[model samples]
Target: MSDPTALLQHTETRYLLCRASDIGEGEARGFGPLAGSRRKIIVLRRNGVLHAWRDACPHYSTGTPMAWKTDAYMNGDKTHLTCHSHHALFDMETGQCILGPCLGQQLTRVNIVVGDEGDVFVAGPTEEI
Candidate 1:
């Protein structure tokens, strides 16, 4: 197969984020798959399920990213997600703001696809930012 990201144009808007192996268990990776404009999205595996979300925090104007460090999404206890900007806690499964200024808000979910070939991709059209 050709380089997946380079082949992404043929798939329209869908861009390959990474292979399943790249994320492993309880890991998250970022991808810029929106028309090559550096749109950052995060894909993570939690409890055997895969989730994709826009890498934007709900409390800020630009909606900052959740992780303070690279791929370090989970809190020190590994129980919830902690924001890099303000240390807000969010539910890993639901993306709900459990503690902090944005309580009751949620991180925007982005659709994802897992190809039979083991590659992961951003799926279909997403709500524009």
Candidate 2:
């Protein structure tokens, strides 16, 4: 049989986000599958690299957003991602929870692809999360 994995490959949807330049170093922005949808995600630009994560707080059973302010998901030092609700900290480079509640847990990393023209896109899970 043809490899089942190969058959299902490239099937996930990749949604276009914003330009790579839009998110500056040490900055982050939030996006969702649709307007007025509570399901959300946040992307960060650190050291000129892009990292995407589901905007969910593992500390909270309901999985709430990490930012207190819009698109402001970093700690004061801009070194790690912070959940404003309970101060859960996560490693921006790896999305692993480094401090606060849910320690050792991690922020769900989204599969993102940056185009040659600097456009950002998330592959898979196009529906409202």
Which residue runs does candidate 1 get wrong by more than 4 Å?
1-12, 36-39, 126-129
Query: Over the stretch 34-63, how does candidate 2's per-residue lDDT look in tens digits?
Result: 444565778888878998888988887768
Against the reference, the lDDT scores of all candidates come to: 0.77, 0.80
In model 2, the Cα lDDT at residue 88 comes to 85
lDDT of 1 at 24: 65
Each prediction's total of clashing residue pairs, residues at least 3 apart in sequence or on different chains, is 2, 0
Task: Return the TM-score for candidate 2, rounded to 2 decimals.
Answer: 0.80
lDDT of 1 by residue, 5-96 (tens): 77666576667888877876677777764663434788888888888888888897678767766777777887776677777888877889
Candidate 2, run of 10 with poorest lDDT: 6-15
TM-score of each: 0.81, 0.80
